[model samples]
Target: MSKAPNNQWWRGGVIYQIYPRSFADSNGDGVGDLPGITARLQHVADLGADALWLSPIFKSPMKDFGYDVSDYCDIDPMFGTLEDFRTLVQHAHALGLKVMIDQVLSHTSDQHPWFAQSRASRDNPRADWYVWADAKDDGNPPNNWLSVFGGSAWQWDTRRRQYYLHNFLSSQPDLNFHNPEVVRALLETVKFWLDLGVDGYRLDTAPFYFHDQQLRDNPGRGKATSGDAAFPDVNPYTWQRHIYDKERPENIGFLQQLRALVDQYPDTTMVGEIGTDDSIATMAEYTRGDDRLHMAYSFDLLGADWSSPFLHNLLQRFADKSRGGWPSWALSNHDVPRVGSRWGGPDCNPKLLRLAAVLQMTLRGSPCLYQGDELGLPEAEVAYEDLQDPYGITMWPEFKGRDGCRTPMPWDSTAVDLGFGNHSPKAWLPITGAYRKLAVNLQQRDPDSMLHFYRQLLHWRRSQPVLIKGEQSLLPVHPQVLAYVREHAGERVLCALNFSDRPATLNLPTGLQAAAVLDLPGLQGGRLQGGELAFEAFGGLLLSLA
Candidate 1:
């Protein structure tokens, strides 16, 4: 008999994030579609992921890819029809893997009917649906708000003879969430997806849903801090405190409303993306109770800080502030550089990849694994001519953009295009030669491959209830080594990871009886001698302690 479904499945679940355009291409159209995702569902289920979170697939103008939605209720023809989506959901359900989709609720493509109508004339029915403000006497923007994509956040509209707010590209306008009508309209759209059988949602730009009602000028940061080193320092978005622009307290009420709507559906969940000055605090606030988001994630783990102190401090800080909240941790995604290249640099070995997998899986929160990370695929080299990300295009040499991480997934080493799609069709983004050796077929045959290690790690994690739902306590160890203990229901496991590329030794906590050393390939297991534990370079071990 099958096991009963748990409504709180997301609490300690593992979610695999799929970038639709790069996952798999069906219909021989050189683009990944719903049918392709449905066909690839087995791979995810086999990988031990409890859920799959798909990026946006709504009707779009392709300005910022699918982030600029032109229609919320329909699927983009490039992706497929509504029926295709329903079929994908059905297939996922059959495999016991829940399906979640990205919901871009902050803004819409300028081509959206509402935006078009609002820009036509101020007297239109949808005029107040979007944020609009009057230009200053000197014909300048009303405030000092800056767009994330560069330039002022306000764009001029000749039809309305006023400036409109756009926190991103000029083609994408921010919605007026203060308006009750706008909030209701967005809720109706959310209901449409819920009715379509999606298990949950990954709220894109969740913190940007509401802006300061007074439209106050934001204060500026003195200089670039170490925290701002995550992305390229080409834009001014990172130079401000961003207090008035995002993470406004008023947004909490809207989140409550959203939570209420999702509560109407059983076994439904929502995970928000929180990016702001104090993202960790914001994550805690958004998920403080069941009245808002079920879980939230920040860019703390996704940044370039891979040191033992950095990781330990971040986890400890979240634990201190989380109270009863939940967090979702991700190492690599479509937005940033791949972890293999980011943390490992040029010499990112298979051992480091295995270590990363072990650390993420053993973390106390829900983990989100991005596509191709299981194969240890590094950032692909997208030449200047092939660059697609607008952020990279604008910032050129200083920041190469996110195109490197958004390349198509490699399936077959011998097949052209690596079996991502038909060989005859040209992919939206090229699959470079560097990923050929890391193809799925190639890795499947190698027991020591990163793919195999990831599979083993995830499967092993599922069997350890203490690692999944236990309370985590940081243990003292060498500065280059991270050690922690997870305990639940009288079961305790000690997890130790060496952050450096050199062997390290540390003394284990006393009064713990070692039961067995977890089996992991490509690295030496820890040996306890006179209460001292020794580990090899990039080695990780989990010990069952009583």
Candidate 2:
């Protein structure tokens, strides 16, 4: 029931990611669901985002907290019903927002009917639906593939009389994409959603779609050696080169197929999550042509790297390699610590948050804004006893799971549980102490708040053609400064960021007359006369040169 728009807004647009479980709760169930999200779509639309990227809401056992989907076409009982999802789509469209749901094609929960049937016995009709193989001579796993959740990638299946491959937890088995039937079934599932009028999809764990058919052992990779990336490492999946286990060239065909499926519907688009260690390269590859993903995102910027040179180099590397493909940039997500907490440190300048918003909007590709980011929410501290994530529980202390980023949204400072729901029952992942002070209600009244800055910055970005459709060039990197130029049809803009904690002097190239200056924090006030640009600590300046 979408009143179709005249144009596809995904290209160079901003997408707001809403992790449903933590977004809002209408039923006072202490968990956000479809109804809660529908009610909040206006907030996203008002923020000037063009689309909404909702994480998985499919039926699941919640083993991986909805990442391990049990049913592709039906809504989880905990999340509501299919009718609720349809209502969400309609509401989002009426407000000029495109809805994109996460599609986890690489694997499914062991609880899925298909996986259950496949694992029932070796000769079951759906036996080939999941990845199965014989053990090596020494009775070890069939190959060296590492699970991101920890331990060996292969788990013995008593019913199948062999081992099944799992790139994550043993509870989530990898799908055998090599089987044509499997491909068709997954496509049908996608078609089911499309028929229900979804505007797009966000493919999860996109790189691991296809595995080595030979079940060959993965070569040792990137400073680690030994079995399946096992315990005590970052997600356990990083230990291997991952060349064989993921990022296979064959994945391009499936991407083409998925793209073809999307093409059947006008204006529908797909953005994939490439979680590979070499994510930039995979992102560039997956989105290289119109036949594949419309755009792809990687974790290159989501980590805790805040140095100016690092950001400059990362942008340069992506631009250098992604000549044909489009890139989608994200500063935070449900799986990582909020950028304010990760990068802002003890004294997070509100100005820097404003500058970050400006930078994201002005970047060359479509930007993704995670929920709670507009309020400048930092990472929450979760005690071990309060932990729920399998990934976090598996590796305690060394690497806490994603619960820090998945806390419920703080709407009011005085409201109990920060007004997340009307429940007297305790809510999961208690709202952080620091976040209570920065709640949306508090910021709405403060014109100079981070929320206001985001609103103003986004409004400003929309009017500038140079920002929306500009070609970017990284300027020479100085010690604590990073500069870049954006050129559109005829306009030229020079943007600079100062990453140091102390005031810094920037010597601009000669012959450029500074026409207008945007006063962003981390940048001190300076008259742009002559060719020199001076900045204060952590200041960022956007200049129009004539």
| Number of the top-ranking candidate, with TM-score as the measure | 1
Off by over 4 Å in 1: 1-6, 226-230, 511-513, 520-525
> On residues 115-221, what C-alpha lDDT tens digit does candidate 2 reach at each position?
98999988888999999998889988877777877789899987767999998889999999999999999999999998998889988988899998987777665
TM-score, predicted candidate 1 vs. hidden true structure: 0.97
Error of 1 at 305 (Å): 1.1
Q: Please provide, for model 1 over 1-546, each residue's C-alpha lDDT reduced to its tens digit, 9 standing for 90 to 100.
A: 222243788977999999999889887788888888998899899889999999999999999999999999999999999999999999999999999999999999999999999999988899999999999899998999989888899999999999999998999999999999999999999999999999899999899989988889999885575273344566778787898888888899999999888888888899999888878888889999778999999888787888998888887878788897999999998889999998888678777878888889888889999999999999899999999999889888888889999999898899888988877437888877889999999999998788887887788778888878988989853588899999999988888998888888877767766787766554455666656778788877778785
Report lDDT (Cα) of residue 188, candidate 2.
98
What is the C-alpha local distance difference test score of each model?
0.87, 0.82
Candidate 1 Cα deviation (angstroms), residue 475: 1.8
- Pairs with steric clashes in candidate 1: none
CA lDDT of 293 in candidate 1? 95
